[model samples]
Target: MQIAERMQGVSGSAIRELFKLLGDPAIISFGGGNPSKACFPKEVIREITDELLRDKADILLQYGATEGYMPLRRAYLDYILPGNGLHGELDNVLALTGSMQGLDLLCKAVINPGDVVLVEEPSFLGALQTFHVAQAKLVTVPIHTDGIHADELEEVVKKYHPVMFYCIPTFQNPSGYVTGAATRKRIAELAAEYNMLVIEDDPYASLRFTGEKVPTIKSFDTSDNVIVLTSFSKTISPGLRVALCFGNKDLIRKMTIAKQGSDTHSPNLNQAIVAEFINRGYMDKHIEFISGVYAKSANCMIEAMDKYFPEWVRYERPVGGLFIWCTLPEGWEADKLFRRAVERKVAFVPGEPFHTTPGAGKNTFRLNFSAEPEERIVEGIKRLGDLIREMKAEM
Candidate 1:
């Protein structure tokens, strides 16, 4: 069978491939970025789902608009957007099956083959794949512990003049770094000045456990070039596959058209459930509850790392998000460490695959805390720390 040429260079998701190793009950996985199962508001979801079936069954069971279920658009406007200092009518919003779909739709809507798309150096792997599949020429800006630097970002934008800049400003995937407010504002300014579309993928902003909440890039978007993709996966439920994008009406329309042939429409029932989840005043309490759960998990992971890992193994304790990004000493390959750790029933994602630049991040890895319990998190870190120590001694 002949596969499409676009897929020739693109490989399967590293995390998904790693999931095949998770069937072993002995393996305590720190690999996948999954929300803690305990964080789910099961009773609330069950009740909401049951009520939707009982009351809104006719609308939910029927086909939904490709644009989206109207209530979700309104709910997003009423509940989600205002918090981010954005306000818009229905035309500005489009429901997505997942925030990942927003990336795909955006690519389909605007990206042509070889169009320059700027991204954070270590970005979300899934978004990188989407850009690759679109045949976009991927360029990257470096990310520091604090996040992308504003001056550096401006330099790159001026140099590349990219069509789109994709970023995860708050608790960025793999890195778990928050781009500061000043940098975020500068990004929005640069977007307007350059006429570049900035895709702000913000799924983890609501997960903050420490520090002040920084304003979103979209909040500083004066020229309307910044597009914000918000996800309920981390906050509400990943299985629901409910996310929404808000931005320039023209861009939203293009993505809506693209979505038509993709899923026809996001599942009406799921949208309705999320809308009800918000409208009924459940989102805040739920987020607060889950944030505490994640906070405890983060603390546990950090404590374990501090106690178990050697001083040479460097890492930043994330303020929020599921991941802890770690860097082994120079010339130490994390891929080799991953193999040895897996043999001992521990797993994490190696970092090289997250970079577009050749031979980058070979000494790095990402550990997710939210998927496992406190004991499992501690145990997994111990196993990984032990493996790292053994590798370092051999060096």
Candidate 2:
């Protein structure tokens, strides 16, 4: 059997591979960006599912529209986007299996082999894999604590003339960085000026725990060059696999068509569950509740890092997000630290795989605060810190 050329050099997600070690009972895993099961609104989802099945089983059990289950799209348009100061008609929306599928469908609709796709340095590994499978030439710009620089983005756009620019503008995945309103505005403008499509993957936006909410890039979009991917995975139950994208109608139409060849349509029952969740006005209360949960966890993790880790290891207090991004000093390998840490029964995702640029992010890693209990968070950080200090001493 022969594999296709598109998948030639693409590799599995390092984060996904780390799941294998997770089966060990002793390991304190900070590796996955998984929402705490405790945070899930179990009773609400069960109620919603029961009600939907009782009232709408025939329709939901049937195949759904390739576009989406209508209510979910309407709910996103009505309930979700409005808080971010975004609005879209039905034609502008497409429901995704997860936000990751939104990326794959976008690649299918827009990218030809070898077209350049610009991404933030250390962007979502899942997305990098999708682009690589689409055989796109990946280009990257650096992302700081504040976010990617506007001027640097413009420079990259001018140089590469990429087909698309993928970003996680709010509470970015690997780094927990948020691009400010000013840069977001510039990104929208650049997208229009360069005729480039912008893919804003924003699963973590609703996870914001502190500070004023920043405007989304799509909210700043005047030329319809920006498309926003919204995922309920973090905010609701990830197992539901419900997400959607809002963007240019034509592009959305293309993606919708591409989606037909993909899943026929997203699962109708799942869509109905999320749609009812939104329409019932549970979204806000739920987000606030989960935000409180994550906020306390994030605080606990930060305090632990400060108390346990050496000052030389760098990281920031995440305002709203699941993971804390950490930078080890130059010449240190996070991969090696990861092996030793795993032996010590602790786990974190090494940052190198999140990065698209060769040789970048070798000394960085991401720790998820939303998965484990506070005690485990503290213990894991302490173990990781000890390993790092021990490694440094050897150096």
Candidate 3:
């Protein structure tokens, strides 16, 4: 069979491929955006499994709804709503194999070929790829410490008049920067004014490690333009692949049709398990515990970089999240740095692939501390630092 050009333009995730090289036992990977296994409620899942089998052995094995299991959908509503001061009945929630699938459905449902989609310059690579595959023109908005630059976004809105603004508002991937509440309100206002859709991909919103909690843009959304996608992957278990999207009723209906043709909804058993997880009130308490672990792990990485990395390196002090963005001094290439670090038994993701434009972010990299043990984080940083020093000496 001949291949499609769109599929040709799409490539495997570079970070996922980089992770495969880590099959070598000598390597210490700071690359993958994975939570520490210690943080997962493994025992709780085992208990859920046992109870599910004992109570409803045959039903757990049966096929389920296209929207998802009703009990689990109801449970997800109860899990996310109270904190945001928003309440929704069963009509508002749609479960997915993962939030990533929700994003795919949204893209297919909303974006037509050549439709403009605004994204963060250094956004989540997966989102970038999804938009690219759908044949949408990817326009970038520069990200700020507080949020995306409002002035630049205004210009984009005026210029391209994009169909959607795809954003990871809380603890953004690659940058780990949280968009402030004022900015979130502004984004919503701009979307309403421009008649654009807002796809808020907030997988990490509930994982705040420090500072005051900020309300989601959806909480302030009166225009019904915002669609918020979140998941249990980071805070709970990634393996089960359960996630949800809450948005305007019309959009949800369209996406439900899109999903029905796609996978016929997310896994029923996984949804059932997650429902039990949330029903038991374990998700709330588990998130707090995960936050603590991430906070300490983040501190370990920052402390290690401060103590060991050269003064020329620049980086953000992430308020909350798994990774830190680091830019090596000018004259140091990130891919070369990755190669050198791997030689020394350490690894990190080169930053270029995360950007919408090519060649930019060549001097930068992202290090994930959430998955590795504290000692491994420190050691990996130390090794990466030494390699950079050695490279600098040669220059």
Candidate 4:
């Protein structure tokens, strides 16, 4: 059977492809958004599993409602709300397979083929893939430390009047920049003023190592214009595959319809586990431990870049999150440097695929620190820096 034209634009993820190439035992990869296996809280989860089975075996294994287990959804809402400074009744929360599923469902509800979708330039590649699969025409807006530039966004709003604006506002993927409160408020205001839907994908908010906690765009929203998606993959265990989505009830009702048709519901067993984890208050301690490990690793990476990388390979020391965004010196080709780095047993994601505009981020690369130990991060940067120097020599 011939495939549809939409499938042509949808291909294997560049991040996943890079991860595949780094599967060799010899390489240290900073390419994927994998959680550190060390922080899984295996013992606690094991006890929960045993206790749950000993007590509630049938419910643990049986089918659940399309909206999810009511208690689990309620617990999840409570768990995530205190951090964001937003509180709503039980109806506000929807459990998801992962936050990625939530994004897909939102696209299914709001995006028609060829509808314009405004995305941060060099945005999360996965979000880009989701919009691409929905067949939305994506336009790029530049991202700064503050967040998506409001002026550029206003220009796009004036021209295309996009249907939705998608972003990973906090500890944003690939870029490692946090959207400041001012920008967050501005985005909310603009979305309200222009009558555009905003999708905030914040999977890494709990990984902060420094600075005050930033508020979500949804916090400033009174007009039901923003949808927020978050996940336990970064904060808790990823193998469980559970996340949360909160938004305007009308939009959420449509998303729930799309979701029911998509997967029926996220796994009930995993939801039960996550609910227990959160209600028991294990998550807070787990995040603190995870933050310490990641903070040390991020610090090590920044320090290595300062000591070993060529002076022109500039990067921001992200206050939190798993990744750092690095820009090569002018005229250096990051894709070529990636090849050399892989040859030397070090791996990273080339920045080209992260952009909505082709070739716009050719001199940039993203390095992840959460998956590897500090020693490995140091060694990897040394190898990558050597490759950078060689690329400069060739130029």
| CA lDDT, every model vs. true structure | 0.92, 0.91, 0.85, 0.85
lDDT of 3 by residue, 8-112 (tens): 778886656876877886688888888898998989999998899889778877877777888787876775677776678777778888888988999989999
lDDT of model 2 at position 108: 95
Q: Give the per-residue lDDT of model 4 (tens digit) for 43-93.
A: 999998888888887986887877777768888677677668877766677
The Cα RMSD of model 2 versus the native structure comes to 1.0
Score every model by TM-score. Answer: 0.98, 0.98, 0.97, 0.97
Q: Give the Cα-based TM-score of candidate 3 against the true structure.
A: 0.97
Kindly report which residue stretches of model 3 are placed more than 4 angstroms away from their true locations once superposed: 13-15
**TM-score of candidate 1 relative to the true fold:** 0.98
User: How many clashes in each structure?
Assistant: 0, 0, 0, 0
Candidate 3 worst ten-residue window by lDDT: 78-87
Candidate 1: residue 4 Cα off by (Å): 2.4
lDDT of 4 at 190: 86
Instruction: List model 2 lDDT by residue over 32-142, tens digit each.
Output: 888998999999989999999999999999988999999999998987889889987999999999988999999999999989999999898889989999999999999
Over all chains combined, what TM-score does candidate 2 have?
Answer: 0.98
Clashing pairs in 2: none
